[model samples]
Target: MSLDYEEFNALFTQFERTAIHLEMRDSYGTAIELPHMAKWATGEPDDLAWLQDWCDLVREGTQAGKSFRRAHVIGEPLSDYQRWSHSIMQPHIDAGSEVRWVPRRLVSSIAFPGNDFWLFDDRLVVFHNYAGNGQIIDFVTSTEPADLRLCKAAFDAVWPLGIPHEQYKLD
Candidate 1:
């Protein structure tokens, strides 16, 4: 099923055990992030106040014994968007979710699904479909055993190769 924003938001807290996200894009045009990215491009400072809601959610989840982890399969010489994303990740890290970076070059042999996804408790997969320019097209959810297995295995293959956010530095 295609999920609206509210439904997608609910999945974060709805999952029972783990919420793991796999991000494959080098850039994204999320509306909320454009303004922040622009501010970053001009070298302006942002207090990142807008991220508080997500931070709170992650904090709450972690305290409840749930795990939130994300793996970004990023390209080398990070794009402007990725660089800015990396800079803003500290707050999320502090809030409780663990962020890791995996260089794209290192994962050429692994078979990944066609889109980005969040695998929840190894049961449901929420696929994030984006247009070529990185604008979100829609959010799709799937629970088929094959789909779940692909997502789980893909994430597993990539996770071990990730460099924790603290140790991943831009060149």
Candidate 2:
């Protein structure tokens, strides 16, 4: 079933220990993230008002003994949006979320999911469906053992190979 934002947040926030996200796209064209992204493309710094909610949540989650991790599988010659996204993720990292960059070609042996996902406590999985322009289409959560297995394997196969956000050189 598809979950609205409130329901999704409620479910995710309930994770007892770890929440892991796997992001495979090179660029996300979300409207709210565009302005700052645009400024970043031009080498001009822009204040990000849009990420406040997420920032707050990461902060709170980390404060309460939860581990928040995100792994980005990016190609060589990073996209403009990826560069911008990396710059913005520092605050999330500072808030104790572990953000890592996995160069895409390195994980060819593993079969990856078609969409991005959030895996909570190694049990539940939430897959994110996004339109071509990056508008969210829906979020589907599943606890099926097969899904958990695949997601967990894909994530584990990539996480250690990824460079931590602080060490990833800006392209």
Best by lDDT: 1
| Residue pairs in candidate 2 whose N, alpha carbon or C atoms collide under 3 angstroms | none
Report the C-alpha lDDT of model 1 over 1-171, residue by residue, as the tens digit.
999988999999899989999999999999989999999999999999999999999999999999999999999989999999999999999999999999999999998999999999998999999999888989999999999999999999999999999999888
**Ten contiguous residues with the weakest lDDT in model 2:** 45-54
TM-scores for candidates 1 onward, in order: 0.99, 0.92
Please report the candidate that would top TM-score against the real structure: 1
Computed on alpha carbons, the lDDT of every model, listed in order, comes to: 0.96, 0.88
Tens digit per residue, CA lDDT, model 2, 1-171: 789878898865699999999999998876677777778878896766677778888888889999999999999889877877888888788778999999988988878888899999998999999999787888998999999999999999999999999899974
Candidate 2 regions with alpha-carbon error over 4 angstroms: none
Error of 2 at 104 (Å): 0.8
Candidate 1: give the clashing pairs. none
